[model samples]
Target: MTTAVLEFPGGRLTLNRPGTDDPSLRAWSSADELLLQEAFEHLAIAPDSRVLVVDDQYGALTLGLSPFSPDVVADSAQLGSALALNAALNPACAAPERVFSWLQPPVGTYDLILLKIPRETDYLDWLLRWSNGALKQAGVILAAGMIKHLPDRSVDVFARTVNVEKVSRAVKKARLITCSQGEASLDNWPGIWKGYDLEAPGARVNAMPAVFAREKLDIGTRLMLPHLKPAIESCRPCARVLDLACGNGVLGLSVLAIRADIEMTFSDVSSQAVLSARSNVETAYPDAKASFLHADGISGEQALFDRILLNPPFHEGGVVGDHIALRLFEQAAQNLSDTGRLIMVGNRHLGYHKSLRRYFSQVRQLDANPKFVVFEAWRG
Candidate 1:
């Protein structure tokens, strides 16, 4: 694996994606270097302090802070693995006190927070809310991202939680924003949205800016949702369900609304999607049994499910790739109970049917539109 080495202050770090094919894909980005410099110059890292590092990508911020504090929070399992692998390569850097593999905030309050803006807006919103409640009054929140991807809305969201100040821009296409605690307000912001009355209620769905097509339903999902009726009808009442790549929990929400007695579980790689799904599930089915987890598909669990609903992601970060979606399918197959089914929606051009056939007893097209198709794969 190719990795980029970053040197600053008292530490030297190497970053890389575990098992990535590209040897040239180094671990650190220019933005990462910029954030490192900013942290060294302005942020005070106390030996006894607990610092939360959000969305550190390949552990740039987490590894960088290892010397000062080992406490860290990472939202992605893949990133967490990469961080562990990199740390193993260099035994000198102190390992984090605790590393969270999911999107949920770390358990305790912190004195300092280092945030690298995520690709999703909804995740960013959830982070702001989590930080507002978890950060101490004297703590400082420092965030950085490329100027182009850093939305103005992020600044607005930060303003609502704390007093924010933008620091000088770095040559590496990045800028840093510092947030200080202030008179806290009730974080009433809805992390999930559930359409009720007109739409079936009891589907807790939250939105984060990072959720793909968050403001509105994705066209692919819209097309696949109708096909779910057949699968839902065929499903046993109150069957255990899994919403693989559950996005904002739209598919799962729809399923819950129709089958009120069914139990649903939502999973997604994006922290924003998980938060949104959790909120939506809570709002729509307050008393219903359902849980949302931040996970990389079926990697977090081995239990088989009766049904799995998926709108798998076709890309990984900025790179257009199908490895993630393919993995989701492979795992879904391994995790399905006997007589269970994996119902998914995908673009028409992608040859997922072949993949599904390899894993399931039968793979059939449930429905189709101009650009997308809903597929069903049953485990014998």
Candidate 2:
């Protein structure tokens, strides 16, 4: 694997981009570089300071401030792995004191919080609400992101937890927002949404912050459901089923709701998605034979599944490509029984049928709308 080198006043660092094998794709962004520069310029910390780093993309911010042994929080398992890899390469920087998944609530009061704003405004909102109770009275929160992605809503969410202290001038098309802890309490948290309606009667979904399609049904899934219901029912005596790249475990949970006989496995490369899916499964079907995996393409477990459901992601770290989905096809093929079938939904523009044809003996389109198509391929 190749690496990108970023040098700052603190030190020079080498790291890999999240979810990609290409070395040319620089891991650290200008926003990440600016955050480090601003932190070094404005923030002071003790060796044992209780600091928190949220959404440190590929470990730039986490490793930069690692000398303080700050606790790190991230949603993607891939990000966590990259951080570990980069930390190993940079021996001088101390590893995080502790790593927290977004599924878990913020643990202790932090004197300084470094946030890299996420794409979803709702996710930023939830993070800020949680930070309200996680920061000390005199704590400061510093957030940075590309100017194009950061809008008034991002600042509004930051203000929810802290008083806006300053907004940095745009540097390299990125900017920083400095905030001071406010008097907000935890009770006012705009918490997660639970019991959202599902197509299956009496089925509900509990979505945490940052999970894709958390607020409402995604159009692709909406299009796929019409075909999934029948495919799931026809693949009878399905002792085991795997929901690949399961987000919030909605696809698996939906199947479990319809066919209670099947043992379901929800797997994703996201810590937050795994945790959310586990919680959603346990809450709805306490006796359900469901397992949640934080895995990259079914690396370790043994049993082959009778069916695999996938709504494979087309992008890795905001870079659009079918590489991930194609990999999923190969993995799904390897994990299926001789009689097993893979049911997947994708945008029509993705041309997934060509990949499906390469992996399975028989492939056919199950359903399609203007923008999305559901395909089923059977292993022989």
Candidate 3:
């Protein structure tokens, strides 16, 4: 992570982001700038305005609007970390309080809600529904994103509820959509539960709109599923196993079906992901001894594990790289027993075999296909 300054209309902010020192990768985006700039110019922003910010990738929107002292809601804990660090660098600005997306929002209605439009339309629809009830009767929302990064149907989704009131002119490859409460309700939104079945163990996987691999099994996980049973069975009785970055708890549920005696913990940075995984396990295996953590990697877990089954994500927010996975590997090494092993799945080109050796004494291939490969690493 490195420091980058965002020069907005009123003032500038110094922020830090985890991974990659690329000069091209700044902490804030064109959308962040345009959203704040437009709001300051067009909207009535008083010192006592009840402001709310959602999906702020880092601290840009919250810190930029520090005069009003806005509140934040985010799905990613990584974003919370970035905002905290960035606030420290710019000591004069006050950092906004953040709540997880799956948790209860801060009390009271908000006069304004600033959002960074996400990449998923389904999630966007859910957010719009949630925002409608959270906003003051006469309040407005400003949603912004890079044109290329915005979902194809994002504007259409916004048109339904918290209806799109106006569209800002394109500035620096970014656009902002102004919205106000409309005659819409979450009557049939994807706010309910749903699941898909895995043929072999019949584990019903559940995922929400914003979760990773929402409705179907991704290729990498499909390649890694067959290898999980053997790895779970190989360890001694009552072995502790972790589904690191577990999205829908499919991997952990599959382990329970094969060996129900082991202890299980599933952790992911996405708060919605943690909720979806917990729902899947509770629906499928009511008595299954499983605990869930909504934190980055394994930072919140205290117990070491005998086997760690990981299908680490290659991308964080929208930036694609191996830095996130590499950090997970180092954390896995710290949380694994001396003879414990880590079984991970990655694209064949990532060359994780070399990276795993940096943390473990030995690394070997477990399975592979045309596009995906699985590796097993352990130190003796």
- Candidate No. with top lDDT: 3
Q: Estimate each model's TM-score.
A: 0.81, 0.89, 0.95
The per-residue C-alpha lDDT of model 1 at residue 309 equals 90
lDDT per residue, candidate 3, 1-380, as tens digits? 77788887768888887687887788888999988887676445454668888988878888888877788888887777877888898888888665546655566788788989899877888878878878888888888999988987776787767667789888999999988886665667655455678775787787887887877788998998888887887899999899989988888888888987888998888888889989888987888889988888888347789999999999876788789899999999999988799999997888888898999888989899988889999886
Best by TM-score: 3
Candidate scoring better on lDDT of 2 and 3: 3
Ranking by TM-score: 3, 2, 1
- Candidate 1 has what TM-score? 0.81
lDDT tens per residue, model 2, 1-380: 45888898688887766556776678887788887887776555444557788887678888888766778888766666677788888888867756677656467799878888887776777667667678888777888888877645776667665688899998889888888876655464555553367866356777766677776778988777766677678776747889888987778878886788888999887776787788888888989988888766777465988888999888765578788898889988898988889989998998988878888889988889889899989866
Model 1 lDDT tens row, 19-75: 356776667666677767766665554556666777777777777877666466665
**Per-model root-mean-square deviation over C-alphas:** 3.7, 2.6, 1.7
Output the better candidate (1/3) by TM-score.
3
lDDT score of residue 369 within candidate 1: 82
Error of 3 at 154 (Å): 1.7
Cα misplacement distance, residue 178 of candidate 2 (Å): 1.1
